[model samples]
Structures are given as structure tokens and as C-alpha cells.
Target chain A: MFAEGPSVFSRFIVCLVLSFLLIVIDQRQQRLESVRATLAVVLYPIHLVVDFPTTLVRATAEKFSSRRELRAANERLRAENLELRFRMQRYQTLERENERLRALLDTSVMVGQKVLAGELLAVETTPSAHEIIINQGVRSGVFPGQPILDAEGIMGQTVHVNPFSSTAMLITDPRHALSVAVNRSGVRAIAVGTGSMAQLDLNFIPNNADIAEGDLVVSSGMDGVFPAGYPVGVIEVIEFEPTAPFARIKLRPHADLAHAREVLFVWPQTPEQDTPAAVPATEAPAP
Target chain B: MSLRNLRGTLLIGLSILIAFALTVLPLPAWAQAWRPAWVALVLMYWSMAVPERVGVITAWFIGVLLDVLVGTTLGQHALGLAVIACLTVIYHKRLRVFSQLQQGSICAGMLLLYVTLLRIVDRFAGVPVPSVSYLTVVTSALLWPWLFIILRDVRRKGGVR
Candidate 1:
């Protein structure tokens, strides 16, 4: 039974070459995304099975918590909810006024976005790739490039959507970048992930820029991926290097990337509204 | 195929599935870097146990499945696992006669080769280099003896070959 067909070396070479071709095709083009997504449908069940132990542990913990603790948590949530409701009333009035002003200025009104809530399933194990798998995906109308947010601020965007789950590339991933503005001065710059969970880098800002430590940074919406005015981070440090023309600015992300369990998937306005005309009048020119 | 052969194949398939599940199980952030290469170990066992039936192709298929599960480049694991399976097939005869400790050392070497190839491909593709986690290889090597016993038990129970 052991001494059969193709020699081991020949079999190895054939499979190796085939895999090399797959690697080349997958890396260079978008052709394999559909294949990957299809395969993900099959893989989703295995993820659920793997996640079962954690789910069971959480459920058991919840069951064992004291009634007094549950009541306390409920009371706290109600108080927070009441506070948010009051703030929302004020925000509605301000939104109406802003729309009227935009009408007066003959600019298109900023459209309200629809968002779907998603529970995070898992975080990727690789430290360098800061990504999370969320429970929402193509079946729930989630798509690649959809902005993900938490209660505090923007988290990241979905990079791959399978049938039952989507993988979001966190804003703190080294490969990710988004256009951001210093809220105090409306100075625009690209905030790039520094591969660290706690920090983001604002690059290409001149040494003389008006940004100061502790200033808030918000999405500029110039890239059209993230909606404008969403809080992204707060400036933590601004260093002036003797050799470089730009200041090295680092920010602490407002979103709790390390602990977020639930996130919002925002469907941004269509690509037509992403044109230059939609940019706010005070936006700084792109660097 | 005979009933015994079918049972053997099923056992092999079950082992692979278990290996994949173990590979993806969530670990604490501090423990993730030390995860043993479970899939590679299982593939190595089968390739050595039944070299002709479970050679490079089976390893490649399992590797691709792992790549998809881990969400990496499609062929990344396939290449490494295929090479390792080929090596196991070439040396299975000599390996069978060696002591368990000696076999464990060779398994560590193969795991090192797998990690090295994976890192080289990642570097060439411009993915950020992972911090050195030779602990993964060390842990996998340490587990090889137990894994060998368990798999041998399964194979004998299934009456494979």
C-alpha cells in the first residue's frame, strides 16, 4: 500500500508550485476575495465552536452574579440612559439649526447615517495585525469599507465581509490610516496607526502647526471612508525634530480598542457625496 | 475502500479537525505568542505514520484551510506544511526507528523551518514582521511525545494499515 503512484519529491513539487500560484494570485489581485468569502461561510461554524468555551464562561459568570449587583448595574445604566436622552434632545435642536444654516449657505445637508450594531466575536492573535471579527457581515448588509465605531469613538473599518461575519482592520493597525483634523484649529492631517494599541501618528504636520498637546482630533471625512466630525483621538505629544520638517505628533485613541465588546457598523453616505464639494468650507488643503 | 480503511481515514480527518480547532482557540494576549503549532504537529504525525497516503497534498490542503481560518495569505501555510510533509515522508523510515526524544528534536527543527519560511514570505509581502516567538516551536516539540502516543493509540484502535 505504501509503494504506489507519484514519488514523494514529485508530489511535493507539484503541490508547492500550485500553492505558489495561489499565493501570487491572491496577493496581486482581488480575484480571490469571493473565493475567500465563500470559504468563510464554511469556516464560520468552526469559529462558533471555538468560541463556545468563552461564551459558556461568560454565561456562567452572569448566572452566578448576585441579584443586588444586577440591580445596581441596571440602575446605573438607567441613569446613563436618562442623561443621554437629555443630551440627544439638545443635539436634535442643534442639528436642525445646522441644517438651516447649510440651506442658507446653499450646501447639501449632511445626511443622517444608519448603523447596525455588531458584537465582536474575536480579536486576531497576531499582534502586528490589529483586527477583529464581528458578528455582522454581508448577510446583514455589512460591506468592506463600512466604518466601525464604539460608544466612545471610531474604531476601524471592515476590510472583509463574509456571509456571517466581517473582519475589521482596527485604526491602530500599522497599515491603516484615516484623515483627521485638529478640532480646535480645523488643521487636517493623516492619522496613521503606529502598530501600538494606545497610539496613533499624525504625519506631515509642519513644525509650526497650531496643534498642541491635549487637542482633540476628529475625522475630516476627506477620505470618504469615515464620516466627518466623529472623534478619533486626542493629541498626546508633539515633538519638533531638528532634522525633519514635520512635527512628530502622537495621539491616544479615544475608542477603547483593547476592550470593546460591541461596535456600530455605519453605512456612510454614497460616493457621490464624497466629492470635493461635500468637504466643509474650513477644511485644510490636503498635504 | 474497506471498512477499516474508511475508519482510518475518518480518524485522520477527525484529528485534523481537532488540530484546527485547537489552533484557533482564544488565548490570553500574553499566551498567544506561545501557542504550539498544533496543525503542523498533526500533519507531521500523519505524514510519518502513513507517508504514502498523507503526503504533501494532504498537508497542503490542511495548510490552506489553516491559512483561511487564520486569515492570512492563502498559500502561506500551504508552502511550509508541504515542505515539512515532504521532509517527513523522506525520513519516515529512519524516524520510526529513533527514540521518542530524538524524534521530538527533529520535529522542533521542522517547526523552525516552517516558521522561518512563513516569516520570510511575510517579510517579502511587506506584512509586519512578528516578534520572535520561538517559544511556539519549543512548546510544540515538548508536546510531541504525548501527541505521538495519542495518535498511535488512535491509529491502532482504528486498525489503520
Candidate 2:
């Protein structure tokens, strides 16, 4: 027990006002970013501590994995690698032909986009919150609104960046909306997050539109956030109402959206790279 | 500060760190929202036990750190936690004399208040927090008694007072 202080109420009131000021300041400006980054610096070690048990479990599991499992995995990877290499040859020829055609048409050709690998940190804020923290941050050239993807498909974009890490809001967040086009019909639709890991909704599609239940939806890149041609999800369900203006369309995302450990941060094309090329340079030897 | 007081502060700081660890602990998706407001619980316990040392200002600071950790706007948790600490301190005297069930009820009320403030701030920030996000209040109230006992034992063993 401690002595009662007369300053308790005063201290509490001051704290309340200060907190309100902080909230308003944070909402309006970037002034508090340094403060947040500094606090994140302090909290990073705690993240490591919280992440330890999972790391330990994964390490032990890796250590004791049977040789047969390893051999099977290696064999499967070898076959997959060969298959990819086989397809890549055809892709290269098509790319060269497309470039030649584009050169004739005076259309700008975009080069390769760079991707950085990052691992999800151990702690999640809450189930209700769709934000996730990853190990990449300002130090790794991570920026706010940078696109994030898993190996399978587009995940989401970064919302906040600290000195050592960043926070990303997943595509399943209720506030998230993505512009997507149906692969089968090429009819564009807006996919809105339903705040669930299992589903998203194409909220504005007309009942009589060209969309189908099984059509694969890919990012149209109209939003300028996600890259073009990345698979977003597959249309899972469609319900039509004669009186209603729009059909209720559901989607199952291509990315796991849950339990994604490794993510790729894509660096989108810069203005210089996207600008139409000058006269053709010397061509490299054929692969 | 005296050496004993320094040690006591360090002990309290260690418990806060542990609470932070629990607050962000990775649970299954179904169980994630049920994490019993660990940081808030620890802040409540300390402010109730030693109001002079861990009161409104400390709670607010911890809230700021938690916001950075959890990736919310700054001061969302700060205002909620400051109010919680304020309530605990205001009623600590009568609360200590009450039965455990009665104290638990008061804690539930405080948890509700904190969650309401959190939701208000969240809504103001345009986050689409659902009505069901109050699950933490239900879970925090249920776990308060056990957490109280554990922290009390730690305080006594460490000679914090």
C-alpha cells in the first residue's frame, strides 16, 4: 500500500488530455511517426521473446525430420523445378516476340519488378484486427502502401512502417477493397473484404453480368496498389435476386490469408521504367 | 531512488514485460480474440496495489507502447488504459476490503469501459470494428481472479512493498 496523493486526479486528467492530443495529432500528421518508430524499437525485443516458442518448435521439427521425408520433398521439388524450367523456355520466346511487337507498336515495355522476402513476426494483434507485422521495415526500404504477396497470390499492402518492421492490413479486412477482373469473361468487378479469412465479396456486380461462379478473379491494377495480373481469388458463390440491382458474389482468396509465414514485398514499376523505350538497343543472344 | 525501491520498480517492470509478451502471444485464430487483456490486467493490478508508483502516467505510457506494438493509432489504448488506472485507483480502498466476487464485478465494469473507449477511438479512425469485438471484455473479466492471485504472490515473494 502507498500513501494517497492529491495529484492523482490531476495526473489522470492530464493523461486523458495528453492522450486525446496524441490521437488527434496522430490522425492528422506525420509528426508522431518518430515517436512511434522509437517505441517500436523498444517493443522489438518483446516481439522476439514472444516469437521464441514457435521458432523453437519449428527448429526442433526441422532437426528431427526423417530422411525419407527429406528425400520425398527433394524429389518433388526437383520435378517441380524441371516443370517450371520447361514452361519458362516457352515464356521467354513469347516475351521476346511480344517485345518485338510492342516495339513496332511504340508501346512501352516494363521490365522486371523486384521483390523482397520477409517473414511474419510471431505476434498478432487480435483476431478481430486484420493487421499483421512483418520483419521488413524502413531499413529494408519498405514503404507505406507497398504491395505484399505470398507465393500463391496477392495478400495485401503495408499500412505502417517502423524502423525495423512494418504492419500490413490483409485483403480480408473490412476496410479493404480490390479492383479485379474475371479471368473467363474479363468483366471487371470490385471485390470488397468481408472481414473473414474464408471469404470476400464482389459487392457491385450485376446479376446478369458476365461473371461466373468458378471464374478466377485477377487484379485489374486499376487501383494502382496491387500489380496487374496477380490472382486475387476464385469466384466461389453467386446468388441472384430479380429485384435487387447487384448480385451477391463470394470469393475464396488464392493466398492462404491465414498461416502465411513468408511474404514478398513487390517494388512496383517506377515512372522511368514504365515510360516508352527509345530506339531499340542491341539484342542479347537467345537462351 | 533507494536501492529497495529501484528493485521493486524493476520487478514491476519485469511483470509488465511479461504481460506484454502475453498480450501479443500467438494463439489459434479462434482463440486470438479471447486473450484476456493481459496488459490491461497487469496495469490494473499494479495501480490497485501501488497507486503512487504505477498510476495514470505509467498506464498511458504503456498504452502508447502497446499501440506501437499492435499497430493502432497512437493514444487509442492510452486513453482507455488511463481511464482504467484512474478507476482502479479511485476505488482501490473499498475494493481491497470487498470479496473476490465483488472485485471481479468491478473489474468487469472497468473492462467494459475500456473496450467502449477502444471502440469509439477505432470508429473515429474509420476502422470497421465489429460489434463482436467486445469478446476480450468477457474473457478478461473471467480471468481476473487467477491473475490477481498470481501477481499478489509475485509481489509478496519479491518484497515489492
Which candidate leads the pack in lDDT? 1
Residues A1-287, candidate 2: write the lDDT tens digits.
44455577888889989998998999877799888888888899998889889889999999999999999999999999999999999988988998899899987775578899999988977567687889999999998788899998989888778888988988888777777899888888887777788898887788889977789999877677777778999999999999999998899999988888999999877777564232221111110
Each candidate's DockQ score against the native complex? 0.51, 0.57
**What level of docking quality does candidate 1 show?**
medium
- lDDT, candidate 1, B115-147, per-residue tens: 898887676555764523668999999999999
Clashes of each: 0, 0
lDDT of 1: 0.84
Candidate 1 residue lDDT tens string, A1-287:
55533577788889989888888888777688898898888888878888777778889999999999999999999999999999999999999999999899987678688889999875353545788888888999998888899999999998778989998888888778889999999999999887788999898899988989999999998876788899999999999997999999999999999999989999877555534543222212222
lDDT of every predicted structure (CA atoms): 0.84, 0.84
Residue pairs clashing in model 2 are: none
Error of 2 at B112 (Å): 1.4
Off by over 4 Å in 2: A1-6, A275-287, B130-132
Q: How much is the lDDT of residue B36 in candidate 2?
A: 82
Model 1 residue B125 CA deviation in Å: 1.6
The candidate that achieves the highest DockQ relative to the unseen native structure = 2
